[model samples]
Target: MKNKEPWYATTADGVPLVAAVPLVDAQEEEEEIPVLVVPPVTTSEVVAFAAAAETTDHPQPSAPTLEESFQQQLSLKEVPTSTTRREQKREFKREWRTMKRQAKQEWRQMKRDAKLEARALKREFRSEKRALGRNLSDVKQDLKQEKQMMKDDAKQIKWDAKSKIQEKKRELHHMKRCMRKNMLAGTFCCH
Candidate 1:
């Protein structure tokens, strides 16, 4: 045997590159194990090599986690038989029916609420219209009362002026009659 020692690869920074175990122990095994003497490469050379070797199309896959492995194994092992598939289909149908029923009930409730709101709005509108009508009528009544009062005042003023004119005409007639009597008597006794 030429060499019986274990081989490993490392960088210049004393960091081990490969951590693989040797297939045969150096002390017990007598077979010759060829040591792969790797040249010491710098970190920059390793980075450049990795960059040159990397491809954009094919990406390396990461190792699966324990939970992910367990789920994958379960999925592979638990193949759905015909009976199990039928049961799943029935369960899905039941769930779909319940969902559809819930949706229909919710839709009907929404429609009912909308109708009630519309009715309430209509009632409010009608009441507002009635109130506006009552207010308009009250305004019209007030205007009529004011017009009647103005007409009555005008009539009273006209009657008072007519009475004054009548009294003035009667005074004028009596004065004329007195003047005529004095003139006829031709005496101071008319005083």
Candidate 2:
């Protein structure tokens, strides 16, 4: 992947070859986006389609309720009057659009409030994420260290067996201490 490659969904030509990064302003706010993914078709898709056709069956259900049957009969009423119908349709669409905009605005406001609340919480509990990150990082460091210690040369092992055992035991004890400290930190941070 290129160093400057986008980090989120963009051109869905096989997951964009990578995702796209959110664009940012000077104050570090992320830009929002809407995406639609449509993949291209090929022969494997056709074979899967053929297999599905061979395996699938459509089952018909029996009976309908009295109200359902009546609605089915009655819904095909006299055709709506043209100009009045068109006017009503236009009004309905306008109302629908107005409602949609209002809904989106409300949703955006709510999200902003939620983000504020999260930031406030984070500020109140400063060092939480850093503490968690440190705990996991320490565990990783300890594992790396133990792995390094365990990589023995044959000549060194023959000459220094007791020293190696003592060193290995010390390493194991250090690892156990790291594990315990990490567990405590994790529980405290979570709570």
Candidate 3:
């Protein structure tokens, strides 16, 4: 037998043990879900990312603790900032125009095309797995749930952010209602 170990036995970070500190800590602490930025593409980069994230997870106790530092004596209104009103208005106009341009149907069409390309790649991989005599159904189901939760989370985030950025009281109130409902829904099923 060779001295080299099998690939399946190695960790993403090349460790023999599969360290699952983040998941374990999340279970123990009930922390609000942290933003999972896309991991870098390379295997080594992903390994490094996971390892670093695991280390960071230990230091985080809960979201309330993190929010406490920013919560005390906070003004509800955000002033136009260091920039004067006129300068802020000009910047907001520029940003709004850019945002409107990006919201156009042509941009949406391009995004749709990109999504179709990604779906095609996923289909190809599924077929390749079938040819390899591997059952990918269980893995696919887990991926489906994760994707749905991510989509809902992203939509909620976008709407919440829009309400904040526009400073719309009615929209903010409505968004809060929706968020409360979502929290209740998750409370029943989310682990």
Candidate 4:
């Protein structure tokens, strides 16, 4: 008997090659082999198996006791819940009214301050203008007094000059009369 390979041989064109082989011979059986016959599992059995496998891999923690849950509820109840919609609306209106009043007061105060400042500035400007006018008037009076003094000085000088000229003319006339009297008495030279 010869050992045969499991796969068949193929040619270049992909056709299976047929070969001459000897046939297998059958012998009478002596002892029978035992066979294992397993039954098919149902859906419930498969689910139970999966659950048991998951639990063994990762264990879950136990739930809280009733006493612990009751204590937690009591702690939550201690905090107040006073923020209702109606209360919030009332608070918002009160704050808005206060803000409006404060803004009006501030605006009035600013206007009053501006008016007072303007009045003070106007008074200061008027005082300065009056002082300037007084100074100009004083300067004009001084100039007038100086002009009058100069005119008087000029008139006095002119009168003094005229008097000196008249005295010189009278002295010349008296000398001419004395010369005429000496010529009549024959006491003066003719040349």
Each candidate: what lDDT? 0.82, 0.72, 0.68, 0.76
Choose 1 or 3, whichever is better by lDDT.
1
Q: What is the C-alpha RMSD of each candidate to the true structure, in Å?
A: 22.0, 52.6, 61.3, 21.7
Where does candidate 1 stray beyond 4 Å?
1-84, 186-191
Model 1 lDDT tens row, 1-191: 45544556667997777654555656675766545445566899989888887744676699999999999999999967656877989989999999999999999999999999999999999999999999999999999999999999999999999999899889888878888887888743343
Q: List the residue pairs that clash in candidate 3.
A: none
lDDT of 2 by residue, 12-119 (tens): 465443333334432343344333334456799799999999889868797999998889778776565547877989989999999999999999999999999999
Number of colliding residue pairs in each model: 0, 7, 0, 0
Clashing pairs in 1: none
lDDT tens digits, residue span 4-57, model 4:
342345689975554333233212323332333334457997999999987786
Say what the RMSD of model 2 is.
Answer: 52.6
Reference-based lDDT, residue 169, model 3: 76
Candidate 1 residue 41 C-alpha distance from true site, Å: 76
Model 3 stretches with alpha carbons more than 4 Å out: 1-135, 168-191
Write down the lDDT that model 1 would get: 0.82
Ranking by TM-score: 1, 4, 2, 3
Q: Could you arrange the candidates by lDDT from highest to lowest?
A: 1, 4, 2, 3
Q: Write the per-residue lDDT of candidate 3 for residues 44-162, one digit (tens) a residue.
A: 87899889988784655655664665664354444436468888799899999988987896789999999999999999998997875544676788899999999999999999998
**Number of clashing pairs, model 2?**
7
